[model samples]
Target chain A: MCKKPLIDLHDDKLFITFEGELTLYTIANIEKALAYVKTYSFNALQLDFQDVTFLDTAGALFIYNLEKYFTKKEIAVTLLLEDTTQKDTLNLIKENMKSSHKSVPRKQKSFLEQTGELFYNYYIGLLSFLHFFGKLFTTNLRYITSLKNIRFKEIAFEINESAIRALGIIALTSFLIGLVVAYQSAYQLKIYGANIFIVDMLGISIFRELAPLITAIVIAGRSGSAYAAQIGAMKITQELDAMKTMGFEPFAFLVLPRIIALVITMPILIFVADMMAMLGGLIVANIDLNITMELFMDRFSEVIAAKHFYVGIVKGPFFAFLIAAIGIYRGLKVKDDTQSIGFNTTKSVVESIFAVIVCDAVFSIAFTNLGI
Target chain B: MEFIKVRDVRTVLGDKIVHDGLNLTINEGEIYGLLGPSGCGKTTLLREMVLLQEFTSGSIELLGKRLETISERDAQSLRHQWGVLFQFGALFSSLTLKENVALPLIEYTELSEKMIDEIVRFKINLVGLKTEDANLYPSEISGGMRKKAGLARALAMDPKLLFLDEPTSGLDPISAREFDSLILKLRDMLGLTIVMVSHDLQSIYDTLDKVAIIDNKKIIYEGTLQEVTNVKNDFIESFFGKMK
Candidate 1:
């Protein structure tokens, strides 16, 4: 049940009696009462809380604010209270309110200022990333000299999690991609009476570009984001700090194992993806272009160069390094919040994929220039 | 008025029995403490009272609503009548302390943003947090400040009942005492029927009006701190023995 405050206006004095529950549920009615009182020009205002059966913090706040509202207009405000607890609440709120001043509003930034801030943040971020990269590089280099400190068990576990677990998805994705590419090219090649050229097209594209790129993107999405979330959660829970206090280098213990595992597994995963893609292409070629599997292998041996396979497989480690490095880097960059874990995980995936593509592009250009 | 009455409450989590025939009564305007050694299911009973966890076979009547047979509508309304402060503050890491304090009012009431802002600031200050800390996120504040901010949010709704899970567990002695006083002050100021799960002996001595000591799947003692020593229980002896 809700009760509206009884308002009495006589001459220059306004008296209001609040009744029943004075809580969030009844605040709207109290606000209406305040609105009614505001219409009158009163030099003196008395708020009677004796009839108020229930008064919570919100209600006390309203009473306090109402007193402040009329007092600011140079009116005398007096609060009449019979209930000791209500009086204590009002007094507590009043005392606390004295210490809490209004926070200064943030100044709006102009367009140029906003742009400068954005650029500055990115610049700082780039510097931090480079620092992390260098630190990790030196740590790995130092560990290479003394291999006893390295946790091979962690590395093995990470390989199992990031690589061995990823095998099924990799196989399915590469197979579908290979099938689609061969099917699309087979339609065109068949029209030109060049059904045999399907092997050359699939071999060049899948081996040199499609397989490596797809495998990298998959790992970046799968393992890169996971690395970021795992490390970020650890950082949030102060496990990284615990590791440091225990005299263990986090990069070596956490990041290095992931990077080493990915580097070891990436080429293996890509090689598997390569075989699966060829298998898919073989089936498509057989069904679509009426080419026999033996004939496809014979043409493939003749047209597909070892150099194409080398180009694809060689990019695997680089791509893996980029994915794992960026993942761990972004993870280390995570601030002390759950939101930052999600934020960094997203950034890790996007940045690693971008880095993989850029590295692939650079490799393609360098190989072209070297006449390889 | 009996604000909470837990009767014949039994909890079976998988194969482990947490609570068996646990019964307790918390009255209005009393600061109640659920005391037990670690893993005695004190928090579980608190959670069960708040409807966060379910007891296997029991009746928990909170604010005149039976928990097991409560309708969805009644459950929603009952939730509004109480506020829970989880362990570790549990402030939404994404929102600042001000936004966190303002959340319940914004969701439950039709108060304008201006009024809500005033209430939020008042609640923030009422819990002894600085005005400047209002803009900072939960992660930005210290442990004591986080607990205070959490108290602000819990009191945001001006609930009649408050459930706090370990309000002073992680604080230093000074801050812990400060928290104890804050709890006492809030209980007096707001007339809140507080049910807190705590193992802090000093906190138990300072703030609790009545306590139910849970040990070995049942309440070993339920009375004031002054009368607690009369109970013959190993947990009560070891737990409150240090105080003596």
Candidate 2:
């Protein structure tokens, strides 16, 4: 609001009236209004607060200072506040004028300084992440060593929610992945009359890489974000605080169950993904490349070894650990705001997906070097 | 001057009609309170007054301008004339109290950094909060302090009119009384025309100059606080408990 308080100079009396609400918000406008006051020199000043609509402590202080300034000049100052409802607040402000804290100005940081601050925040985030993992590992080891506080029911529920409930989407995506790989690879193999080799391609690709990759990606989107949001919501509502006050370890009670569920589910999901993807490839190979199911099975058994399937399922629990860990970690990162829940959920899903891909690439390099 | 004038205002919420032929005028330098049962749309009527929602039919002229026909520029300009304090304070959770109060100043004016800082401090102090609390986030503060911060944010623009929703519902008796007096002081000093929706009997009895009680899809009672409480109604009796 650029509305400066209007000062109307009348015959033998200076009537300074304020228009609109007089509060800290109007302080800038009030300053401009004061400048309007400073320009005039009247021996007798009558400050009429009759026209002011709303007055608070700031408005009171302004009027008080204005009066003080005039009284200092030996000018007659008449404060007519009889018309305003803020007379009491004005009185209170007048009483407290001596004690009002003079606000100190904080220095503004340069762009480079702000950027350095961000790096510090990032460093803190990394250290906290390491601390969280360390706590989780020790708690998990303690639980393993002592079976007394094991929450079997919660782990079962977690498995049901994050794994059993995720079966449909996982099966669908894995099947599609297999279908896509077989169809694309058959196009190249078919041009050279090597359509029979589609079985080897589908079997090895689906079992070794495609199944585990698609399964991990699906879980990352579904269960990973869910864990983050669930834990974040709990954190926001102070349930985590209540648990800590009651001498309950959040890691043992909350985190371990989800971890156990994810670890158990991941290997099983990979196996399911392997079956579905191979099934999808079989369907695609039979339809697109004119290869019989019998011939496909024969080449599959001969060309693809059992160790290929083991290679895929073996990485499942590790990927699951990465997904669940990041999800819960991001969940714990959620602060007091509602928006942070959504933000942490997104971050968890993204980080889990990235971790999965990075782990897959590492496996690729290692497996290639080892000739597996 | 009539700060807000509503005529033939009909607001339909889904299948139910909330305001049927609603006509009211809020004058300048007055404290108007809205009273109703739990689901009687007291807050909704306040929203209607603020143009947070428009009536299904009829006209509302705020600050001598019809809200329905107002342009975007006019609406944004008109926003400076009034400010609303939502029930939950609705302070930006991420911003500290001072930053929240300074938001409107930064957005609406070209006031210098120093002026903005001083103004923010003043506003926070005006709400009876210490200037030191300005640096604390809303979550770090107590509920009373949060409400005060919200009040500071609402007063950031220093509009001619102010709207409040349940200003004292969560406050204890003393805090509520203090808040009521703060309202009185604001109204007296600034001469602000304010409309508030409140369920607190003490707030209703002590603070407001005028009352509008909505029931049966309309404002059944409208008068000075003395006149409305004098009415013989079962709902009013139960809600206010035969106002002392």
**TM-score for each predicted model, relative to the true structure:** 0.60, 0.51
Q: What TM-score would you give candidate 1 relative to the actual structure?
A: 0.60
Q: What is every candidate's C-alpha DockQ against the true complex, given to 2 decimals?
A: 0.02, 0.01
Over the stretch B1-244, how does candidate 2's per-residue lDDT look in tens digits? 8888878888898788888887778898889988888888887777776656677988989898897787755665677777777766766664688987897787568999999999998898898999888899878988888888888877887878888989998888899999999999999988888899998888888889888888877777888876665777877778766555
lDDT of 1 by residue, A247-330 (tens): 246887788999999999998999989999999999999999999989999999999989999999999999999999999999
The candidate that achieves the highest TM-score relative to the unseen native structure: 1
Count backbone clashes in candidate 1.
0
Off by over 4 Å in 1: A11-15, A42-46, A76-78, A105-111, A147-150, B1-244
TM-score of chain B of 1: 0.98
Tens-place lDDT per residue, model 1, B132-168, is 8999987888988988888898888888999898999
